[model samples]
Target chain A: MITLKDVNKNYSSEVSIGPVDLEIPRGGITALVGPNGAGKSTLLTMMGRLLGIDQGAIEIAGMDITTTKSKDLAKIVSILKQENHFMTKLTVRQLVGFGRFPHSKGRLTAEDEEIISRYIDFLHLAELESRYLDELSGGQRQRAYVAMVLAQETEYVLLDEPLNNLDISHSVHMMQHLKDAAEQFNRTIIVVLHDINYAARYARYMCAMKNGKVIHMGRTEELMNNQILTDIFETPIEVISTPQGLLACYH
Target chain B: MNSTVALTPKPRTSRAPLYTAKLGLGCLLVLILLALSLLTGAFDIFSGEEGREMFAISRVPRTIALVLAGAAMSMSGLVMQLITQNRFVEPSTTGTTEWAGLGLLTVLFFYPSASILFKMSAAVAFAFIGAMIFFLFLRRISLKSSLIVPIVGIMLGAVVSSVSTFFALQTDMLQSLSVWFAGSFTSIYQGQYEILWIVLGVVIAVFILADRLTLAGLGEEFSTNVGVNYRRMVLIATALIAIATGVVTVVVGSLPFLGLIVPNIVSMFRGDDLRSNLPWVCLGGIAVVTLCDILARIIIAPFEMPVSVILGVLGATVFVGLVVKGGANAR
Candidate 1:
């Protein structure tokens, strides 16, 4: 379980996020969905302990993020941000090996290698494991990075915009993979998604935010109504029931 | 879907033999250069007692200084590039060497009789502070092109060097300052050159922290998320760079592009996994510097030219090539 209580971050005189109080339960997919500049990434990063909280507390499985040693926190939670750049040349397999750093500290054991291979296979990146990251396409690279985060084997996986550069089929594939990981591994996954339809399709829970505040938090079905999403996005959003599922169309 | 299919898992093959081969070749090259450097000086080692004394007191120490300073500076350059996430950044380019110079000048002005240890510590402190300032500036200004980083660093170095020049002129130490700035191993001896051994310790520490440094190069958020203390790693990298630069600057003066060019050249061949790339970087550094030192000795026989002059010509050419390559990549 992840908890944020009255958490705040002040960027400048005119920009600040939170006084947010929220709890994300353990297990399944919880999607944070909102428009741009809605502090989705900021909140996710703060929970990941990539960014420090100015006020209040965030706890991952009852361990206070602010007080917990980073090495300890790393075992319980892992985060993948949107933009990742590397100065060194690293193969996909080597990059995934870094996910075991908290445990192995660069000396990967046979067990660690087995786990790495499993995650690579899970992400369907076994063919590309020997390929350098710079040689891969954007979607392939994104999958490699996701594989790295999964190889961390953390209970709480927080991903900020995992679908940023992916195509339609890849996006769906990624969501399905995340869903399977969440269920099979019994891990809690919090993902910040841009496509409301994707969120509606795969997420078990939804947290809608606007102007740095969580305006709506409930079951995915409850948060799928037209009025709620329209208010949260400040746009005319129409929710129509299709044979596939509930889909929200803004255009 | 076919593309995503798993291949048969390849057996893990030990790279120890390949690494050993590379190490063997590198050591052979450095050893050859070391032999040439030891033999090329004014006194003949194949002769009598005076020649043996000269070999012991002068040539051997100078050769050792060449190896130590070379390896240390190049590793320093590699560390700086990793920390800054820029390819062109090095101790000289990033104002670190200039800051060390300023520290040396200040010490010379205030206490003319200061020990080498005091001078080196002062320089290290200033270099660390200077590198910290550069990082702070980097955080504030979001640069689009990687080329701008080194340009800004060079300008920052110019600013610091100007300050040193100003103080040197006022204190009437301009001539002495210029001589010190032109790096050479001519003055190195057993007594005066022992301080450079600190670089070996720094190199060992860097080897231990190699993996962390590579992770830190991935960016702050990713590094911290992976449980590497990003700030602590940066601080450690900064200290290593400062000590390497400070000790080298004090012992042999500033080797302008030795740091910049050596690492770039090594990475072009070995890639940038810090752990694997480290030994190659050190060996390449030692080889390049020793070769340059040999040239410096023979270029003006019986009278030596400063090693920095040769390095400057070679470094500037390679630096320009890198900028062009980087610009082409940006496009």
Candidate 2:
């Protein structure tokens, strides 16, 4: 369980993210969907303890995130941000291997290595495991980063816009991977995504934000209605049922 | 169950233990080089019977100065690069060395006969303040352009160097300033070289904070997330770098590019884990300095060229190599 009590983030005179009071349940995929500058990234970062909260507290899995030591928090929750820009050269396996830093402290044990290899193969990155991150295509690099997060083996995975720079097929594959990780491992996956359709189709729950506040949050089906979607996004988004699941079309 | 079992492959450590071995060997090589440097000198101190006064006074201190200055400057460069997330930055490149030079000039002008310790303290403090100013300027510029960072730093260094030059000329202290600027290890002796121990203190502090420093390199938000105090880390790192530069400048004069070259070379062999690669950087530094010192003594045959000139040529060669390699492998 992750609880936010009166959390607020104020960057400048005009910019403030929250004074939000909310609780996230123990296990499920919660899709944070909103427009640009809607505090989606800021709120996600705060939950991950990546950004400090100015006037409130956050607790993850019965532990106060603020007071918890980072080495321990890293074991419970792992986060991957939107962009991964490292000047040094690293192969996919090498990059993913760093996921075990919290556990192994850079000296990887046999078990840690096995887990790293599993995540790599799970992401279909075997062919590119030896390739440097900079040498790979955008989609491949994105997958590599995702694999690294998965290799972290944390119960809670926080990813901010994991689909950015991915192609349509890779995007779908990534969503499926997240869903699988959530279902199989019982991991609590919190993802910030732009595509409402993907959120509607795969997410068990949805949290909608606007100007730093959670305007609407509920089950996927309940939150996919036309009136709620249109009102939240200020656009006419029609909900439709496809063969796979529910989808929201904003065009 | 069978499918999942088949799917999961055994994990293995990507980094080899031999990498550690290589680093250890590198350190051993540096020690050997240092020993050789202690034994050899300008007056053929090794050839005669019992060691003479020149060996005790000139040769030993000069060698110690080279090793300390080289390692400290290179380590400072590594720290600067890690903090700024830019490979091109170094103490010299970022004006820390020039700032120290300016500080030395001020002391010379005001309290010409100040103790070596007093002169070094003044230089270290001024250099730290200058580095902090540059850091603040970086913070104020919201838009981060990597190229502009080094350009701004170099320009700042040039401005400070010019000020020092102008003052030196006015006070007829240009001779002293010019000699210091040339970065010669020749004049270092026992009494003068103890000031460089301050750099060893900085090195110890750096080793203690190595993991946190590595965390800081990942970016500000990430560093904070990982429980590293970013502002504090930057302040500590900047202070260490300035003191390292100041001590080196006082002991052996200014050795340009010693800072930039060693870190890059070490990073090429080892990955960016500062803790692991630090030993490699320090070793590479000692090796380069010892070799350069040997060449500096041997090349002119009884008349020694400054070690900085040797380092300048060597550093330029390595830097050009890196640039060419970077261009060839442009992604």
Candidate 3:
């Protein structure tokens, strides 16, 4: 379980994010969906302990993020941010191998190597495993990063826009993989998403944010309403039940 | 589709055979350079009885100095590059050498009778402070342009350098300062040259800490997420780099482009895994410095020029090449 108590972040005098209090239960896919500039990434970053909270504390599985040693907290939770750029030119396998640092501490045991390869194959990245990250396309690169976080093998995984440069098919594949990861590993996955329909499809719980605050939070079925969708997005969204499932259609 | 992969997994990527061959070639080249350094001095060791003494006193020490200082400075560049997260950053570019020079000058000014070890310490301590300042600047600025990082460092170095120049001019030590600071191995005899061995500890420490350093290289958030303390790693790296730079500056003055080019060249060929890149960077450093030092000795025949002159010219060409055509292998 992840809990945030009176969380606040002041970007400036003109902009600030919550005084937000939220309790995210363990073991399912929870999608943080919001319009642009909704502070969704900010909130996720705070929960991941990437960004410090101004006036609140975040606890992951009873371990206080501020006080718990980073090395200890890493085994319990992992985070993947939106933009990750570094000067090191690494292969796909090498990058994924880094995900096991919390467990292996840079010395990869045989088990660590197996886990790394498992995540690689899980993301359908087996073919590109030996390739350098710069050699892959954006969609392929995105999958590799997702593979890295999954390889971390933490109970709680936080991702900010895992589907950013992905095409429609790749996006579908990614969401399916995340859902599979959650169910199989019994992991708690929190993702910040821009696409509402993707959230509608795979999100077990929907946490909708608007203007720097979480406006609605409930089960996926309960939040899948036309009025609620339209209000949160400030667009004319109609929830249509196709054979595919519920989709929020704005266009 | 669940396929059973091997537990050990094959060696990463296409590195196994090619990496060994490359390191083997680098080792062979280092050996040849070492022989050349041993043979190409003013007195030929094979010719006379005093020649063996000259070789022992001067030639052998010069070669050791070249290898140690070479490996140390180049590795220092690697560490700086990793810490700053920019390929262009190194002791010379980041003004670390300049800061060390300032430290050297400040010591000489105050305690004109200071020992050589004292001088090295002051320079190293200043180098550490300078690197931390550069680190702080990087932390404060967003770095929209990658080029701006080196520019900020160069500008900061210029400020420190001018202060050194002012002090040098006032004390009438400017001429002596430039002479002592030139990247030359001319005065490296047995007694005074053993101080270069201190950096061997730094080189070994980098090897032991290679994995943690590489993790730390991926930036703060990534490392922190993986449970490594990013700030502490940077501090450790800076200290190592400062010691290398300070000691080298005190002993050999400054090798302007040794740090930047060696690591960039290695990464260009071998990719950027520092643990793997370590041996190559060290070998490349040894080869480049030995080759340049030989060239420095031979360029003027009976008279010798500073190695920094040759390094400056050659290093500038490669540095510019790195900048203009940088997008090739560099990401």
Candidate 4:
């Protein structure tokens, strides 16, 4: 379980986000959904220990994230941010191999290599494994990054905007892979997403934010109503039942 | 569906053939450069008895000095680039070189006959302080704009340089100051090169903290999230860089672009994995410096042009090549 208590983040004099208090239970997909500037990404990053909380503490899997040593914490949680721009020319396999750095310190054991291969296969990145990261298309690169986080083999995974720049087919594929990872590997996955329908479909639990605070939090089914959707987004949203599940239409 | 079906498990990268071959090639290049540097001088050192004495006193010390300066400056550059996450940064860019030159000028002006040891000590102190200031400036700015970092650093260096030049002119020491700031390996004797040991110590520190530097490059939040002490690591890296830059400047009088050229070339050949790239960068630095030193000796024949001039030309040429190649690669 991940817990945050009264977390406040002040970027500067004018912009501030949250004294937010929230709990994310273990063993499911929890999607953080909100419009731009809603602080959903900020809250997720803070929980992942990627960002510091000015006035609060975060605990991941009962370990205090603020005080835990970096190598020790790396074993428990892994996070992927929105951007992964590197000046290095790295093959996909070489890049994913870095995921084992905390464990092997760049010396990959056969077992480490095996785990890397498995995650690569899981993300359908096997064929492009030897290609350089800069050589791949946007969606392929996104999948490679996700694969790397999974290769980290941490109990909890945090991803900010995992679907950014991906096409619809790739988006669906990526979400399905995340769902599979959650169910099969029993890892707690917290993802910040812009697509509300994707959140409704794959997420077991959902947290909706407006400004900086969590405006609504509940099971996915409970949060998938037209009234809550419209209020959360501040736009006219209609929910229609589909064969797959409930889909929210704003346009 | 077709793409998913086409997926195949990736083969593991071995440390034997592929890695070892690259390592061997790097070592070979270094060894060849060392021989070339030892042989290429004014007195035909490879041919006769005068060769051995000249080899021991002049050629040997010169070669060792080049290797040490190259490795130290390149590693310093690599660390700067990593910490700042900007490609254009070097020991010179971060104001360490300028500060060291300033320190030297101040010592010369204040105590005209100060011992070399005292001068070097002052240079190290001033350079370290200047590096700290650079770090503080970086800390104050958001890491979101790393592109602005090199610009800020260059402007800071320019300010320090102008101040030093102003002081030099007032004291009529401008020529002496210009010679030291211009960067030449011509005056590096055995006693003079002793300060470079401090730079070697810094190289060891870089290796020890290599992991932290790599993590830090991922950004402060990510590094902190993974449990690194970001502020402490940055401070340590900055101090080491200052020492490296200061000692190199005091010994060789500053070698323009050795740091910038070596690391970028190494990164182009090898990936940016610092652990692997470091040794390669060190070797690459040694090669560039020794080769440039040789050219400086031979290019002007008996007159001997400064090594800094060679480095300036070489660095500028390589810088242009990298920009053009990077653009072409992007296309």
Candidate 5:
């Protein structure tokens, strides 16, 4: 389990997120959904220890994030942010190999290479493995980065806005891939998703945030209602049940 | 698996043999130039005992200094570029060499008879501080483009150089300062050039940390997420750059653009994996400097020109080409 108690971040006098107390249970996908400036990414980054918390503590799998050595923590949690820009040119395979750095320290053994290739193949990037990252299309590059993070072999994977710039089909494919990884690998995946429909369809649990606070957290069904999402997003959101599933439409 | 034909199979298929051939050719060129540099000086190596004495005292020391300074400066530029995530930056552009000059000038002003060790230490200290200041300044502003970094660095360097020039004029050591800043291997000797050995040690350290440094170049969040201690790596890189710049500045004066151009050229051909690219960068550095030093010797015969002038013209031309290509790509 990953636990956050009184977690707060004061970016400035005007913007702050905090006093959040929550527990994200292990296994299954938890989608953090809300409007812009809702602090979903902030909370995810804090859990990943990419951002510091001012007031309280975060514990991932019973180890405090702030106290744990970064090298050790890396073996437990892996995070992929929205934007990853590299000044150096790197191939898809080489970028995935860096995911093994925490374990092998840049000297990848046979086992590490096998694992890297497995993630590459799993992500359907075998064709692009030798291609440079800059040469890949947006969707392909996003999958490549996700492959890299998954190659870390960490129990907890946090991705912030992994679907940005992806077309609808690619987004659905990526969500399916992530859902399968969560189930097959027995990993807890927390993803910040902008599309509430994807979260409703794929996520087992949902955490809604607004003004830097968790407004609601429960099973996907419980948070799928019109009242809660409307209150959380501060917009008129209508929930309609279709043949497929419950969908939230704010249009 | 689905059949997805490789779009660029030829580049991959031809890379290994091409890399080997390039390495072989570079080594051959360096050897030829080293021979030319050693044999073509004012004193003929074909002569008897007097020639042997001259070779040992002047030619050998000069050659060693060129190799050490060249390789170290180029590697230092690569390290700076990685740490700063900017391709245009080098020790000269970053005010590091100018700070060393200022430090040397301060030593000359206060302690006219100061030992070389004292001068070197002072220069290293100043260079370290100057690099730290540049890093801190970079942290404060969000850069619009990579070109802005070197532009800012050049401005910083100009500011520091003016301060050194001001002090030189006041102390009436303007001629001495100009000679120190001109960067020539003409005065290098066995005893005077031994300080560059410290740079050799620094370069070795850089090699050991090459992978980590490359990771650090990927930005702080990514590097830290991958378990690298980003701040510590930055500190280590800063120290390496300062030491390399300081030693070269004190020993052979400032070889502007030698650092900037060699690594840029190397990365243009061999990608940016530091461990693999480092040797080529060093070899390129040594080869370029050896060629420039030879040109400096032969272009005016025994009169000789400073190697910095040749490097500056070459570096500027290449830098402009890179900038133009980069701008076109961005557009």
Candidate 6:
């Protein structure tokens, strides 16, 4: 379990997040969904220890994030931001290989190499393994980045909008991959998502935020409602039930 | 199962032999350039006892200096570029060599009889400060363009060099100062050039920290996420660059573009895998410098030009090319 206790971040007097206290249960896909400037990304990054928490502490599986060694935290949790721009030209396999760095300290043994290849193949990037990142298209490159994070093999994976720029099909495929990764690996996956429908479909639990404060946190079933959606987003949003699943329709 | 990740017939590391062969070829080319540099001097070492002594004292030391300085400077450039995350950054461009020159001048002004080792330490110390100031200062400024980084560095170098020139002029040691930092192998002889070997330690250290350094190029958050001590690696890289720049400045003067051009050219072909590119960067450095030294010898036969002139022209061309072509990606 990951716990945030009275966590606060003051961007300025006018802009701030928390004193938030929350508990994230272990071993399921939890999606943090909110509009822009709602601090969903901020909260996730703070929990990942990518951002500093001003007033409180965050713990992952009983280990304090701020106090634990970064190297040790890397073995337990891996985080990926959306807008990754690499200066170094890396092939898919090589980029995935770097995921083993925390464990192997850059000396990739045969085991590390096997794991790297596994992640590459798992992401269906085998044909593009030898191709440079610059050579890959947007969707393919994003998948490659996801493959790299998966190769980290951390029990807790924090991803901020892994589907930001991807088209519809690629986004669906990415969500499916994350779901499979969560179930098969028995990992705790936390993601920040803008698409409410994607969150409603894939996320077992949904945490909704508004104006830097979490509005609600519970099972997706409980949170999917027209009134609650409108309240959290502060817009006219209707929850529609279709043959497939629940989707938030806002027009 | 977990072991089933490798689904295809192609094994991992399939490119190992090909990588080795390409590296071997690059080394072979550098060796050939070394031979050419060794044979290109004005004096005839093919004659007698006096000629053989001259060969041992001057020609051998000069070529050795070229090899060591070249490899060390280029690798230093690679390290600095990765640390700064700027393609154009190198010792000369970043004011490191200018700071080293200032240190050299300061040592001579205060203690005219200071040993070469003492001079090297002062140069290294000052270089460390200069590189740190540039790096830390660059971090605070949100640069409008990455090209502005090297411009800022060059301006810093110019400012530091003006101070050096002023001090040298005041002491009437300007002529010696110019001659010493002239970036030449002309003054190299057996007893005077051994300090260049200090850079070999730098090369080895870079080899040991190659992965961490490369991760640094991916940016602070990325490397930090992967468990690297990013700030610590930056300090280590700066120290390495300073040591290499300091020692090379003391021994062979300032090879202005050697660091910039060699690594850029190597990266053009080999890409940015520092661990894999270590040998190629080293060899590419040796080849470029040795080839330039050979050209310097023959260009004005019976007299020599400092190798920096050739390097400056070549480096400026590549620098311009990178700035122009790298427009979209410079940010």
Pairs in steric clash, model 6: none
TM-score of chain B of each: 0.96, 0.91, 0.93, 0.89, 0.93, 0.94
User: What lDDT does candidate 5 reach at residue A131?
Assistant: 79
* Interface RMSD (one decimal) of model 4: 3.2
Q: What is the interface RMSD of each candidate, in Å?
A: 2.7, 4.6, 3.5, 3.2, 4.1, 4.4
Error of 4 at B318 (Å): 2.0
Candidate 2 residue spans exceeding 4 A from truth: A10-19, A54-56, A62-72, A91-94, A101-118, A121-131, A151-153, B1-11, B18-40, B46-53, B142-145, B320-331
Worst window of 10 by summed lDDT in candidate 5 chain B: B9-18
Stretches of candidate 3 off by over 4 Å are B1-21, B47-49, B140-142, B327-331
| Total backbone collisions for each predicted model | 0, 4, 0, 2, 0, 0
* CAPRI band for model 1: medium
Instruction: Return model 2's CA RMSD, one decimal.
Output: 3.4
Candidate 6: residue A43 Cα off by (Å): 1.4
| Tens-digit lDDT track of model 5 for A1-251 | 99999999998997899889999999999999998998999999999998889989999999999999999999999999998887787778878888988998977777888888778878888778877888899999999999989999999999999999999999999999999999988889999999999999999999999899998889999999999998888899999999999999999
Pairs with steric clashes in candidate 4: A70-B226, A70-B227
Q: Please, what is the whole-model Cα lDDT of each candidate in the order they appear?
A: 0.89, 0.82, 0.88, 0.82, 0.88, 0.87
Model 3's i-RMS, to one decimal, reads: 3.5
Candidate 3 docking class:
acceptable
Please give the C-alpha DockQ score of model 6. 0.43
Please tell me which predicted candidate would have the highest lDDT against the true structure.
Answer: 1
- Give the Cα error of residue B118 in candidate 3, in Å: 1.1
Better of 3 and 6 by DockQ: 3
* Residue A202, candidate 4: alpha-carbon lDDT: 94
Per-residue C-alpha lDDT of model 5 across residues B1-331, encoded as one tens digit per residue? 3535345444321022225777878878888888778876766766899889889999989998888998999999999999998888999988999999999999999999999999999999999999998999899878778888888888999999999999899889999999999989899987889888999998899888877998999888888888898999999999999999988999999888887888888877766767777878888999988888988888988788988888888888988988898898861
TM-score of each: 0.96, 0.89, 0.94, 0.90, 0.96, 0.95
lDDT of model 1, residue A112: 90
Candidate 6 lDDT over A54-160, as tens digits, reads 88899999999989999999998889988787667767777888888899988888889888877787788877888889889899999898888889999899999
